[model samples]
Target: MRRKVYTKDQILKAAYEVVENEGFSGFTARNIAKKMGISTQPIYLEFKNMSDLKNALLDEICNHLYYDIFPEVRTGDTIIDLGLSYVYFAKEQSNLYNALYVQEYGGGKKMHDFSYNYFHQLIVKHPKYSKLSENKINALHVGTWIVVTGIATLMSSGIIEPTQDEIVHLIDRTINTVLQEDDTSVLDSL
Candidate 1:
């Protein structure tokens, strides 16, 4: 019998699907083999180790988050839209969210740092935040992300069922409080 062959893309795609359905713990060579109907030897041949495969899967997940998920969250406001999108992402993809943020399965940048970096980049891109200093922007991101993550966790855990409007109001209040002084001193206390 001829040995089965699997492309790198096929293996990575299978791995992503396994993780998407089974969370971070589900991403294993055996699972990918089962998903793709191939032997684990093909997976091993395609990837040096599980870590390598995980990095590839992380890239795929980031792409999904940035391209597929982020675009759908819009409210004519960058900050609000991103916040809503984050919460919605948690609700919709709780397993992936927990794996990326809570479990740190990607093993590279933590979601907290990623969120901070994302918020900074987002702030820089918008004219409204052009005048703000880096520290102030960092403060604002931390403050607002706290609220966003809290709402996401609650919703994802099924502990609470807040509507989108209520979430928007909470985010607005958090942003206002963080930016009210328009100074970096608030960041010191945080």
Candidate 2:
């Protein structure tokens, strides 16, 4: 049968949509091609293998999450709102969230490391944290992983029955206690 040709962008987009709607386990060249109304050959021509396709998808998800959501999270902003937004994001984009945030689709240890580095850099950039030594920055990396991951995990798992406001407060109090700082909008000044 003759097949339609899809661009690299189209295939990657279809792959992401498939993962979001069908979950990571549902991801495959066949399904993606079906969604794109094209053939697997196009994907093969664009990518070395499925891992390459997934890695591309992961990179795209990382870019979207970091630029659209993570940067918008102001430390000086309402902790409740931040927590609410996080939960909302998870629920709203469950499939992407599960794939990028939860699912072990393609060995996401590097993704985790990237997240850890991101927060650590943010902390280092903050005037409050700038005074801290290298050890302090390292400590913040560990601290952020423990706290933020815990919050994200809780919301993503849907096991904790907490309201947005309550979750915000919980997250705020936890971060505040650890940082020993009252300000929430740490990103604005920088």
Candidate 3:
């Protein structure tokens, strides 16, 4: 009898399929083996442990997001288009989205940190936002992120199915409300 052989790339690809289809809950040695149509021994041979495999999977997901997904999501409006694209990605890739966003998979770096950094860059690139103070931009980013993430969660979970127009409206309202910031209740009390 000959032993079956599998490459590291093959193993990682299978692991990605498992995570994409079954979410993080399905990210196990057994699932990867089943996806690859092989035994678990090959997985152990290719990687040190599940953590190693998971890190590899996270890298793949990030690559897909940056190179494959985000590129297709672009529209004229950098901010609204990004939000819409995020929502679309969640709907299209629910299981993958859950693994990346819902599950704690980044090891040391968290999903929120990644989002904040991305938003920071987006803010800096915007003509209107370019002159704003860093603190104001950060506040606006938090506000917009909250709304966008909430929408993505709802769409991913099938709790609500909003139209593209609705998503745009929501993002607009959120950004406007946060950026306006006229009322100062804290100072009123003081």
On residues 122-158, what C-alpha lDDT tens digit does candidate 1 reach at each position? Answer: 8898898878877778788878877888999889899
Candidates arranged by TM-score, highest first: 1, 3, 2
RMSD of each: 2.2, 6.1, 4.0
- Candidate number achieving the greatest TM-score relative to the actual structure: 1
Supply the TM-score for candidate 1: 0.88
lDDT of each: 0.79, 0.66, 0.77
Going through the candidates in order, what is the number of backbone clashes in each?
A: 0, 5, 0
CA lDDT for candidate 3: 0.77
- Per-prediction TM-score to the true structure, in the order listed: 0.88, 0.76, 0.82
